[model samples]
Target chain A: MTCTAKKCGIHFQPPSIILIYEDQNQEKTRKRIMPIRNFSKFSDCSRAAEQLKNNPRHKAYLESVSLRQLQKLYSLLKGHLKGQSLAQSLEQVQREEAIDPEEDMNKLDDKELAKRKSIMDELFEKNRKKKDDPDFVYNVEVVFPQDEQVESCGWDAESDEGF
Target chain B: MAAAGGDARAELDVDVDVDAGPGQEKYDAEENVKIICLGDSAVGKSKLMERFLLDGYRPQQLSTFALTLYKHAASVDGKRVLVDFWDTAGQERFQSMHPSYYHKAHACIMVFDVQRKVTYKNLSNWYKELREFRPEIPCIVVANKIDADMKMTQKSFNFARKFNLPFYFVSAADGTNVVKLFSDAIKLAVAYKQNSGDFMDEVMRELENFDLQQKGEDFSDKEESCPEEKPPST
Candidate 1:
């Protein structure tokens, strides 16, 4: 029996993650309410999402659900718990996931740096084309446009020591 | 419980469908009152809630949100009131509660541990914060854990008298004045909601309308939109 996850939502009052799914075998849509337990504003969203996804009761139904989606839901819940509006939470999540090229990563603390790295990793995974993808290309090469002058970094500068 | 009888004058329209089957006896609440609890951490705010709710309680913790919502179906002056008792799930560590915690709140239960003098002193700060958000709503000052030292109740607590607010000496451990305090709170909340024509309600209503508009486009769209991209079918 195959199940396709359709939608996911959070109920702030009772603080439960509501999932709507379509069961291929029965050809019916059903809802699953997963109550979030022992979660606090300071709780880790990723860890909580992983726990929920791997729970024995939800494991079967949430097979099609992505860990990132679960994490996103948890993040929203966290924001709401911190007394932030839904829009505020969404903006925060967007800000976290987005990497600013102008921002220096060297100044970030260990925990913050790790978070940024994880965001970069997730973004990379999303954009990567797997072998099974229809549009997957092998060894595709493109010529670099030399019209614009590129700023040279110290590493890119010609090394004084010959290799 | 003496104060409970005096406020019974506020009559609410009763549901005529009392004979509507065993399982279908749904009490349609006249008002949804949000009563928030504020106090220092480990002051037994959650314990007081638990004591009040007793067997009819199903603790709904949204620790991620840093609060536990205890829903109670209360009958005040023949009117069914759905009381949402919001307990700070150790949010006191943040020094100040989130502004959203006080949003649309009809009443507040400010508690402090009797044994801890610091907790008692911190009441002024909590009261100040609460008044900043909800100035018109009824605020109750509770001296909890009286079971530890019953003698403490004899000493005059001027904090409640200073603010001219109702005071209760409650013990979550042995359930002393727990029922009275909660019931009185519900009554006060219901009364406040009915009489309140405050500007805050107007602001909340507008905010709620804005929320409704956003709910359709932003909230639902995000919820329904699948994150994983499915392969295109030929």
Candidate 2:
């Protein structure tokens, strides 16, 4: 499929399409589903319940938060809570509270929420590197201008051409 | 231009001139042109960047974890220039604080809100600080936010007369003389990098000395408690 510019005469190349098959058709092996004990229940559900008593069901919440955040939340109630900025402590407490089982059943805003996944990914990477600043920074997204980006505008070959 | 018009906004995320360069081209060969904008809070540095980058320069809600960089590739005299831009905040809190992002900038733009002449007066401190950090880098002194009240339309070349930096007065809100200033800046950056230009450096040098008194710096034997009242710029 071709991607047309929303309004202008320009057209952009569509991203490459990937093909997937339900069965490993004559190739790769079949994957099996295995369950580890619901370890998340102890940390996410229980702690969230203990903190706020209200957690709306979220299909993506458990999958979204960083592992460190989960561990921190779990540990917040583990011993005498570790040293944390008031903001950090409150954020952890809220995440636990947000994961409670008997909360409301509203839907989630997926697009806005995906922003956190990247933040979580950055945090996990920073923790692994053991850096001084573990927060996700915008520099992580200093993207190289893509070919599609080049198609946008500037340097008219005619009137402004000494190029 | 899509900028001065409508319906073209959503459609164009970028504006590239492929036919101009036309083919598998090498990355711009010219040395990168780094432009840094520093000024007091809300003096419109970011707005200027936005006006130059995107037509709608919204007020930044949060500090960029670091400075912002935008790349504009252009070819002049068969040389390609990739302009790397840095836009900074002018809050006093950030004044002495090291810019984690200001390492090797090639040129600097010290902006002031034209409406607030105090901002205009203090352009030197910003210039001094940055020059102390990168002496050889060329600079452009810009008076911004010209769209607001201008008690009178007096042509105050006061900012320009004082310094050697190329001085420009622009209203980013209305897009008055913005592109010309930007293109001129890039041209100056190019000339400086190649050591082929005189006007830019010459202008900036005069600009530096012109506003010394206005900046509350005493150039006299004893620090002058009050500056000699020079008439406004014409």
Candidate 3:
């Protein structure tokens, strides 16, 4: 996807899950042909077992990492994601004229978009003051899920890492 | 043992759903699942949740006053999974008071910082808390902050073995392993939620040992000792 900003243009390669194809009675089909970009993300029996196999430090390495460590890693990534998003959004504004969020976000230059998002986020954070927890800090966006409506929302990609 | 089936019967008094087909209805899958994050304050709980919950993160102030909820939708391997994650505060005393907002979660995620030993030590208390409210939940353990120092990574591995919880070492700051942790937790949650049976006994057993409820009752020691108590069964 290509997004154009007033002064800065940016290109986007969506992480995944952009399309949905379903036939009436039969179950919806997943397009497996689509490449799974983040291989390291899926840590199940296979992934965990692989950790034991892949590295020489496996024994010693496994010793230190804990759930809290994962939690902190996630928080840090959220920051990374925010930066990526602003970049993507600024690109979006430049590319489309739809006036929808996709367009509105795309309209701003990267710096301008980042500035707006940062200002609002700063205002909320300062007012909310989540600094007390030092070892771990998370900024969560909570939205109520409506069960009845979800199934109908075509191409649901809510979990997209860059979402 | 059939008793395993019976005890499971007691533990499970959830409103039973009669089958859509002869016996097939019971095997019916749910469209939704609950995933909870538990950890200490300043350990990056809220920030991690925001990364996964929202499309991206905002470099703003973070204070987890109340439980924040986020939902995600995706397909794991093949099955469509909707993950409902709760980002909770990590303050010690607050940890106890909060999270009681719900019961019997499908999955639990515990996060700790690698550099700090205190966060590592508290995993015991956090694990105990998991057992209390949602005993049968599948847990994923994470070691955060690998970027700042490698020494902490050493500490992180040590912490993982103590709990035997599935461990992931990632740099949320650099965008490393962040997605993997989210994906894995959901997959495991779905796997465990679906196989509530295959692992049901194991989960109940874990709960028995780690149950904070039992520990809580013992600590309160408020039960009255009656000399002439009448048997209700009589």
Q: Candidate 1 vs candidate 2: which has greater DockQ?
A: 2
lDDT per residue as tens, model 3, B1-234: 122333554544445331111112111235456677776554556656665545433322225334455656768878777555666532343445243333435777788765454555566667775664555667888766555454443332433444567776655554346667787788887787667753454554455455657676552222133213211110
- The clash count for each model shown is 5, 23, 56
DockQ of 3: 0.01
Give the DockQ of candidate 1. Answer: 0.01
Q: Which candidate has the top score in lDDT?
A: 1
lDDT of 1 by residue, A1-163 (tens): 6889999888887999998999899999999899999999999998999899999998998898777778888999999999999999999989777756444343455567556656644543454444456874433322222222433222212431211
Order the candidate numbers by TM-score, best to worst: 1, 3, 2
lDDT of candidate model 2 versus the reference: 0.44
Off by over 4 Å in 3: A1-163, B1-29, B53-65, B90-93, B97-102, B198-234
* Per-residue lDDT of A137 in model 1: 42
Error of 1 at B52 (Å): 1.1
Is 1 or 2 the stronger prediction by TM-score? 1
Number of the top-ranking candidate, with TM-score as the measure: 1
Worst 10 residues of 3 chain B by lDDT: B18-27
Q: What digit string (tens of lDDT, one per residue) describes model 3 on residues A67-153?
A: 222222332333334554554544543342121222232235555544344433332343332334454344222222322332322
What's the lDDT for candidate 1? 0.69
Task: Indicate the residue-level lDDT of B76 in model 2.
Answer: 55
Across all candidates, the chain A TM-score values are 0.73, 0.19, 0.19
For model 3 the local lDDT of residue A152 reads 24
Q: Individual DockQ of the candidates?
A: 0.01, 0.02, 0.01
